[model samples]
Target: MSTVNPNPSAAMLVIGDEILSGRTRDANMYYLAGELTKLGVDLKEVRVVSDDKNAIVSAVRALSTAYDHVFTSGGIGPTHDDITADCVAEAFGVSIDVRDDARVLLAAHYAARGAEFNAARMRMARIPDTATLIENPVSIAPGFTVQNVHVMAGVPNIFQAMVASVMPTLTGGSPLLSQTYRIDSPESTVAEPLGDLAARYPDLSMGSYPFTQDGAFGTNIVIRGVSGAQVEAAMIELANLFPRG
Candidate 1:
């Protein structure tokens, strides 16, 4: 039998004290997961780190080595605590400084808006040696890529825009397909058969989500796989086993 190759795996590192303190609820991870799914990149892990240098560097090294791609959001800002670029450089053992190309970009952007590209804002231009920039159309300050790690802005819109800039450059595998079947029965009622169905199709992934609607319990069965045929077949079997009321 021919073996099907697995999708490219990815991990996300969300860096900021605000996220851990509950002051900011992160929307970047959710958005990245969906976008990567469409691009056939499997997001296997997520990590949130504070503004601490050791924490950020350690997490970056770990995730970069563990996954095919690592996407980081937050901490590339123009503030004292925004040290993601520095930590990323440390992780890769690379020197980082304000590169001229990035500086020119920021300067022109500020000039057009009649704003001074001051020293504080100039911090945004600092990039690691030999790293490529990820375009940020939303805000002109660009994100950078060093090794397998891609660092982007913490702002939701700019993070999304950077993801858009980065997505087209990576190689992807087969797009995952999924189908959901809603059963007006409790999970306990469907557990045995669902388990059996899952066992029969080891190539596919099946999950049962419990929900309460109008004081009644129900389970939504989702079947996912790389092959559309497999997903559809499993979905049909799932529906047959647990028909809706």
Candidate 2:
């Protein structure tokens, strides 16, 4: 038995000038996309913005309103460039400062490591007034949830940790299931028949990917939908249309 929900939509905002400048490659978006899918949350859009206050605030406002959830990665750190927390507060027109709850957690962790909670490091404790803290197992610095937005770290490991912390609380929908068919012929030869099959199964999504295997070219066709029975039936019809060798 499984819990079923109709639609749980989400958007992701990747905030970093480094990403746009090609100084750092983004992994959080890809990772979150996969994780959200398994949790039955449909990731609708992804936006990449620089470390600017106005830009981050604008993106947060738009995404938070458009989708049921908005996940953001990057810019909540102990550096001057990290402006995500303040921007999120501005988006909701709320106050932000170093909260005692966050400071206590960070202070204890730093003391254990024999590191000083200096001016810059204390920046991690700067959380929005009304936000709830998201536990960060990798680093003592916590992420947070301000309203519908989940502000996470840029580092893949910590971002993943924050995601794990937040996922259990979200309402997920029906799991999305998929089926695949392999055609021995080239993609061009397979396109027409594939289109016809896709037309027949309007409830499902059909995708044909051209791949080169051992110096030979072929297409891998995938059919995906929420209904396993429908997907299985479609796979059978696909095999019949383009008999496998």
Candidate 1 overall Cα lDDT vs. reference? 0.92
lDDT of 1 at 123: 99
What local lDDT does model 2 show for residue 93? 94
- Candidate 2, 188-221: lDDT as tens digits: 9989988888777777888899999998988999
Candidate 2: residue pairs that collide: none
Q: Which candidate is the best by TM-score?
A: 1
**lDDT by residue (tens digit), candidate 1, 153-240:** 9999999999999999999888778788888988999899998988888888888899999999998988888988887888888877
How close to the true structure is residue 42 of candidate 1, measured as C-alpha lDDT? Answer: 87
TM-score of 1: 0.97
User: Model 1 Cα displacement at 138 (Å)?
Assistant: 1.0
